[model samples]
Target: MIHANRWYAAATAAEISTQPTEHVICGRPLVLYRAASSGKLVALENRCPHRQAPLSMGTVVGDDIMCIYHGWVMNGAGQCVHVPHQDSVAPSVRVDAYPAVQKWGLVWLWIGDADKVDETLIPDMPWTEDANQSSVFIRFHVGANYQLMADNLLDVSHSDFLHASTFGSHAGRKAETEHVKAELDAWSEDGAVYGLRTLRDVVLSPMAAAWAGTDKPVTRTHKTCWTPPNNINIELIMENDENKVTIHHDHLMTPENETSCHYFLIWTRDFSVHSGYPTDEDVRREQSTVIGTEDISMVEAQQRNKIQFGDPADIPGAADKIVVAVHKRIAELQNEDQGLSAT
Candidate 1:
């Protein structure tokens, strides 16, 4: 289920311009644009009240959007400002407006109660603003429940099998795949859930070794933290006798519906800012390939199976501890929203 009180990423800041962009979050169609006058970001219901045509198809005029279908103009506040061949527009004629803001290079919106709009709820990705680091932002549309995608990120054990050819190549050297699953730690605190894994003296995948500028075995520490409403940040630290490197992966998921979601990912690294083996484009391409092809492909199939079987009573493995905790945390949040005790 979708939580109303949390902020969800609607689009990247670069995606919103004078030209309207459309996105669906929490099953609500929204049109996002920047005002020509004040350059402020605005989010409105995609549908126009006059003809039910998509407002995103219209043009931005000053701090307002004019519906192209019938020349109905709506102010940034969603109030009807003007109408063709009419002196004044009806006060009751208006569309829904959602609070939108740009934070950490993303356009975030609040689709719930006006009184509950909280900017502080937006998580911080300080690496995005750091000048010394290299950061790449990528997004995709996943054909699965947002929870399924969350499950994928919370449980990294699948990396050995699903991403063997790419990021998990070195981790899958053994047949049983028990080495990578060792030292798993899961916990919940302060409205968030977390998972940590530490691998010592392990061979890095080709891509990761190239990033580290070394192919030698290294101690790798991986941690995943999940905030409410499907925001995850993964911090990876790799160290050896020569050098140490750190990378931060920030992932945000917003529900388009029960069966689909929009995934936003930002990959930031403290190393490789200047001359490096993996250029920014290289990092982007590799990350896009692993996530778009490997992770998303698996989740979509999982969604299809879930639809066919309704719900399966499969046995849970040891690596599923974090995934289970995250599921329970989400249920608790939903219960709190509904004024019911968590079961």
Candidate 2:
């Protein structure tokens, strides 16, 4: 089983309401809703214990949820507060309640032991909270393993080939010797692995030029960090003589199951907010075309190949250094979760 102690970004805070929202995290079905009276977000097992009906199908009344099948009321604590036909409520009649909180405009849920929930594990993205930065949020349901998505994000080499039409430039599409010359740096810290690639004085694609507000030769840096069980933050910086632009990406992947995932994406930039040069809709459309079509298509194809061929012994190259680190960290976390390690 995946480590439950880690928090997952289940849904946007605005998505939750008195009407229950159903989501699957780490292969477990969960129901999320806000209390009618208190407006506090609550998460509980989707099932109603009495008849095995989905609690999400019930109505929210004050701080409790009343089952539609029969008027059985369950509170935010997962305790059955009222049974229409009975005078006494059994203390044992309760469902599993997971700890949940609203942070960074998202509803985060902890799926493991309630007592071990760590609030610090949630990603800290001050840019998302910054009023000066204009941000765009998008969510994707990917028909692929979450690991594959994480690996794809950590490895920037694929962008040259896969994203050629959208963001790739001649500097990125070069011989292996040129690729080897790109400075590569990687490290691990605080349960995360970071990788940075610096490309010096490279030609910029049209979109990249527009985003950076420069068509001249530029120094580009691609930095990505992956935090287990599944979250990645990417920073792309393009610098020319007159202008420097930085784009921040927040990628959150929550496993819907072993073979599928929920991908939450956010793109923020400081330069374009007030300039009115590239509108949010324009950027969103470009990203949707590149990510929704190109990126997702490639990853899903890779996933299909993996499923058809099963796990194969593959050779790791210099570009795969960060990928190797990610796999090692995930294995370590899984081992720890299984009580195989003290650290």
Candidate 3:
């Protein structure tokens, strides 16, 4: 079952202007738009209840949307406000309306009971509002289950082998090996799993060196936190005695359906903020190459394998501790949401 009570990042605020946008979250089709009159963001079921036509294909008029099929109009509250050919609007003719808000440069939609929504549960992205940090946003449509992507972030040991040329370095590999052999501390708080690790005296990869402005050995700290129903934040710090660089990553995934998802990513850093050492396009290209070419390909293949052969039984290792914990937490949340006790 979907974690209906949580907020899901649907789209970037800039993407929804005067036109209606369509998004599928938690297996539900939603249409998002800003009212032309009030400029308020609104989310409603995408389909018109009359003929089952997609509301997203219709045009916006004032604070309401007109169905293209028959010119029927529905307001932001999903109330059937006007019917072109009818004398009176029936009170029962209305679609479902979802609560939506814009924060941290993104549009967030609540998929469940509106009365139960807690604003504090919306994960924070401090970098998005920080004046000292430069941020870049990108979105990807991944052909894999959202949970697989979460697992990938929880266990980043794949970087050494999967991202050899970009993020792998001899010293980084050595540090990773040692870190995997040692115990990793992961705990759950407020329905989220957080894992933190610090690797000392590690060699920096080219990308890390460029970001840190140094090629010497340094201490690297990686912190990964996963919020239920697909939200991940990663804070990476590269520090030498004199210089320190911090990169904060936000991974927001919303399920398009059972087998696919929409991945929204934001990479914010304090390195060379005003110097433009790395252009936005340059950073976008590098990240796109790594995640698009490397991670998505691998995860999609994993999904295909799962589809071909049911869930395979595999032994967990030391490096999989965090990933396993994340799965267990998800199961707990789902069970609780459905009013069932965990066995």
Candidate 4:
């Protein structure tokens, strides 16, 4: 089910260009491109009203897109402005035009009432815009439900095993896992779910150790917030007596269909922006490997099992607190959209 009246990350700013790019959100196929004249972002229903041709296959003409099937040209507002060898077109001959904007290095599209378009609803990721931060942005098409991807992120316990070689501390994996389990706290408030996990005197992984400038055990803190429509922000800090490093993780999941999703992430860190340890390329390579292989691999497998056996009634555990809270919030939003009382 899709939530209404919300902003979803359609694509990264760099992803949209003069060439029409197709992206699916909540099963709605959208064609995104920059206006040839203004260079502004434009989003329109991908399907043409005539013959149901995909607008993404068309070429951008001025501020409009011309359908290659019939030469029917549609403007940025999805209005049929020109028809080859024909007179004026009917007002009814148009597609839906969504409100789109570029912010925090991503393209955000409003999926609800145009009158209620609010840019503030977009989740904040200041680290992506900050000049002094080293950031890497990556997008993945996951063959899994968006909820499953969100579940993987909200439940931090998986890193102990799934990402043992990357994010997990090899020397102290067992102790750190136990520490996170015992100290984790999760709750929902003000239409958002939050998780706070603090691991004291925890051994850091190799990459994290390098950034923290220490191989000794340090105090690691994780603060995660999940907003509606699958947007998560994680603030992670690892500190020792001598050095501390902070990393902001922005995870955005938008449904391509009922069973597939587009996962976008931006990892920004305060260290190594100007000098010293790890370079930007190093950070990018590490994060790309970790998220692409470890996280996506597990979720895709879970999705496959879900398709074959259907959803199972499983017992909830302590690590499920944040995931549970997020599920509740999503239900509440869906209820609100349907004019039903929230459970």
Number of the top lDDT candidate? 1
User: Tens-digit lDDT track for model 2 on 219-330?
Assistant: 8898988886678899999898889988898899888887788888888887878766677788788888888898888889988998889867668788788888888887
User: lDDT at 100 for candidate 3?
Assistant: 87
Can you rank all candidates by TM-score, best first? 1, 4, 2, 3
Q: lDDT, candidate 1, residue 145? A: 86
Superposed model 2: Cα runs more than 4 Å off: 172-180, 339-343
For residue 93, give model 2's deviation from the true position in Å. 1.3
Q: Report each candidate's C-alpha RMSD, comma-separated, in the order given.
A: 2.7, 2.9, 3.0, 2.9
TM-score of 2: 0.93
Instruction: Estimate TM-scores for all models.
Output: 0.95, 0.93, 0.93, 0.93
Q: Which stretches of candidate 4 lie over 4 Å from their true place?
A: 170-181, 339-343
How far in Å is the alpha carbon of 113 misplaced in model 4? 1.4
Count of steric clashes across candidates, in order: 0, 0, 0, 0
Query: What overall lDDT goes with each candidate model?
Result: 0.85, 0.82, 0.81, 0.84
Which number leads on TM-score? 1
Return whichever of 2 and 4 wins on lDDT. 4
Candidate 1 lDDT over residue span 179-245, tens digit each: 5435788899998888998777777777777777677888778798989788999998888998899
Over 178-267, each residue of candidate 4 has an lDDT whose tens digit, in order, gives 443337898888888889977787776676788788888888888999997789998989898888889999999988887888899898
By lDDT, highest first, what's the ranking?
1, 4, 2, 3
Scored by lDDT, model 3 comes in at 0.81
Candidate 4 at 183: error in angstroms? 0.9
